[model samples]
Target: MSKRLANTLGIILALLWIFPVYWMVNTAFLPASQSRSTTPTFVPFGGDFSAFSRVLTPSFMNSLFLSLRVTLLVVVVALIFAFLAALAVSRFRFAGRKGFILTILIVQMIPAEALFISQYKMLQGWGLLNSVAGLSLLYVAAVLPFTVWMLRGFVDGIPADLEQAAMIDGCSRTSAFFRITFPLLAPGLVASGVYAFLQAWNEFTLATVIMNPSTKTLPLWLRGLAIQSNQATDWPGVMAGSVLVALPVIIFFMLVQGRMTSGLVSGAVKG
Candidate 1:
C-alpha cells in the first residue's frame, strides 16, 4: 500500500477502536431516559452529573479500597518473586532449572476455572475467604507465572557481561548488579507491572468464585450496582460505573506510556 493509504487505514482503525470508549463516556453522563432511548445521542450535549453523583456511595469507596489493596499486593509480590526467579533461571545453572521453567509454562496452560474449587478449598482451609489477603494471593499466583516468563526474556536480553565488567573494576558482584544490570531492567519491571495491574484490576470471574458478597472488588461492585437497579436498569449509572472502573488503568497507562515502549534491550549493552 502507498504511504497515504497506510496512514488512512491506520486512522480508520484508530477511530474504530476508540468509538466504544467514546460511546461509554457519552452514555455515562446522559440522563436515564436519554441513555435508554431508541435514538442514540452521539454527543450528549445536555449531559447530567446525577449518575456520577449516585455512583460515589460508601460501598463504592469500600470496593475501591479493596481493589486497590489486591492490585498493590499483586504488583509488589509478583514482581519481587518473578524478578528473583527470572534472575536465577537466566543467570545460573542448576538441577531442575529446566523443570522449573517448564512448570511455569504448564501452569499458564491450565485453565483458571479448573483450579477454582481447589483454590477455594485451599483458601478456606487457611481461613482466608472474604479477606483481601486471600484474594491477593490468588491474583499473585495468577499473574506470577506470566510475570516470570516475561522477566526472564528481559533478563536474557541483558548481558551478564555488564555485571562482570563492573566487578572487574573492583565493584562487588552485588554492587555491580545494583549499579549496572538493575538500572537497565527498569523498562521490564514497568512492563511487567502494567500487565499484573490490568489482570488484578479487571478480574471478575475469579473474584466471583473466590470473593463473597461481603468482600467486593470494583468488578463485583459494578455488577451489584446493575443488579440493584431491578426493574429499570440504570444505563447511565452502569456506564458511569464502567468509566470509574477504567479510569485507573487509563491514568496508569498514560503515566508509564513512554517507558513501556522504550524496549527491554534499549539500555542494555550488546555484549
Candidate 2:
C-alpha cells in the first residue's frame, strides 16, 4: 500500500476505536430529556453536570475508592512477585526451574471462569469474601502467571554481560542488577503493570462473585446502576460513571506511555 493510504487507514482505525469513548462523554453531558428524545443530539451544547454530581455521591465514591484500593494492591503485589519469579527463572538453572516456568504457562491456560467456584469457596473458607485484601489477593493470582512470563522474556533479552561488567567494577551482585539490568526492564515492568491494573480495574465476573453489595467496586457499582434505572434508565448517570471509572486508566496510560516507548531500553545491550 502507498504510505498516504496506510496513514489514512490508520487514522480511520484510530477514530473507530475512539468513537465509543466520545459517545460516552457526549451522553454524560446530555440532558435526560435530550437523551431519550426521538431526535438524538450528537453534541452537547449546554452540558449539565447534574448526572456527574449524582454519580459522585458518597456511596459511589466509596465504591470508587474500593476499586482503587484493590487495583493498587493488585499492581504492587503482582509486580513484586512477577519480578522476583522472572529474575529467578531467567538468571538461574536450578532443578525444577524448567517445570516451574512451564507451570506458569499451564496455569494461565486454565480459563479464569472455570475456577470461579473454587476461588469463591476458597476465599469464603478463609473469611476473605467482600474484603479488599481478599479481592486484591485474587487479582494478584489472576494476573501473576502471565505477567511473570512476560517479564521473563524481557529479563532474558537483557544480556548478563552488563550486570557482570558492573560486578567486575566492584559493585555487589544486588547493586549490579539494580544499577544495570533493572533500568532496561522498566518498559516491560510498566507494560506488565498496565496489564495488571486494567485486569483488576475492569474485571467484573470475579468481583461480582467475590464482593458483596456493601463492598461493591466500580464495575459492580456500574452494573447495579444499570439494573436500578429500570424503565427510566439514567443514561447520563451511567455514562458519567463510565467517565469517572475511565479517568484513572487514561491518566495512567498518559503517565507511563512515554516510558513505555522511551528510556526504558535506552542504555541496555540486548542479547
Candidate 3:
C-alpha cells in the first residue's frame, strides 16, 4: 500500500477501536431512560451528570480508592523486585539460573483462577483477608512473573558493554549500571508499569476471592452493580463507573507514554 493509503487505513482502524470507548462516555452522561431504550442514542442530547454523581458516591469512592491503592502497591513492589531479578538473570550466571527463568515461564503458563483456592487459603491463614495489603500481595505475585520476564528482555536488550565502557572510565559497577544502562530501561519500566496497572486494575477473580464486604475493589463493586436486577440495570451509572475506573489508566499511560516513546527511539538508534 502507498504511504498515504496506509496512514488512512491506520486512522480508520484507530477510529474503529475508539468508537466503543466514545460510546461508553456518551452513554454515561445520559439518563437511564434514554440509555435503556431499544433504539440507541448516539449523543446524550439532554445531557445530565446524575450518573457520574451516583458513580462517585462514597461506596464507589471506597472501591476506587482500594483498587488504586492495590494497583499502585503492586506496581511499585513488582517493579522493584522484577527489576532486580531481571538484572541478576541478565548480568550474572549462577546455579539454577536457567531453572529460575524457566520457572517464571511455568508460572505464567498456569491459569490465575487455578490458584484462587490456594491463594484464599494462604491469605486466610495469614489473617490477611479483606485487607489492601493482602490483595496487593496477591496482585504482586500474579504480575511478578510476567513483569520479570518483561524486564529481563529489557535488561538483556541493553548491551553489557555499555556498562563495561562506563566501568573502564573509573565508574563503579553499580554506578556504571545506574548511570549508563538504567536510562535505556525506561521504556521497559514504563511498559511493565502499564501492564502492572492494567492487571491490578482489572483483576476481579483474586479480589473477589480475597476481599469480602469491607474490602471491595472497583471491579467487585461494578460486579455488584451489574448483578442487581430490581434497580433496572442502571446502564448509565455502570458506564460512568467504568469511565471513572478507566481514568487512572488513561492518565498513567499519558504520563509514561513520552518516556516510553523516547526510550524506544533511543534503543532503536543505539541498535
Clashing pairs for predicted structure model 3, backbone only:
none
Compared with the true structure, all predictions reach lDDT values of 0.86, 0.85, 0.84
Cα lDDT tens digits for candidate 2, 1-271: 9999999999999999999999999999987878898887888988899889978888898988998899999999999999999999999999999899778767776676888999999999999999999888878988888778778888999999999999999999999989999999998898889878978998898899999987899999988887885898889989999999888888877776764444324321110
Report the Cα lDDT for residue 261, model 2: 48
Model 1: per-residue Cα lDDT over 1-271, one tens digit each: 9999999999999999999999889999998888777789999889989899988889899999999989999999999999999999999999999999888877876777888899899989999988888889888888888788878888999999999999999999999999998999988898889878988999987899889897799999999988985778887888899999999889877876664455323331111
Task: List the candidate 2 regions with Cα displacement exceeding 4 Å.
Answer: 1-17, 251-271
Candidate 3 C-alpha lDDT tens digits along 1-271: 8999999999999999999999989999998889878899997799899999977788998888888799889999999999999989998999999999888877776776778898889989999988998889988887888778778888999999988989999999989988989899998898888878878998877888888866689988988877879558898998998888888778877776765465444331110
Model 2 poorest ten-residue lDDT run: 262-271
Residue 168 lDDT, candidate 3, scale 0-100: 96
TM-score of each: 0.87, 0.87, 0.84
Who is ahead in TM-score, 2 or 3?
A: 2
Instruction: Name the lDDT of candidate 3.
Output: 0.84
Write down the worst ten-residue block by lDDT for model 1.
Answer: 262-271
Cα deviation at 35, candidate 3, in Å, is: 2.7
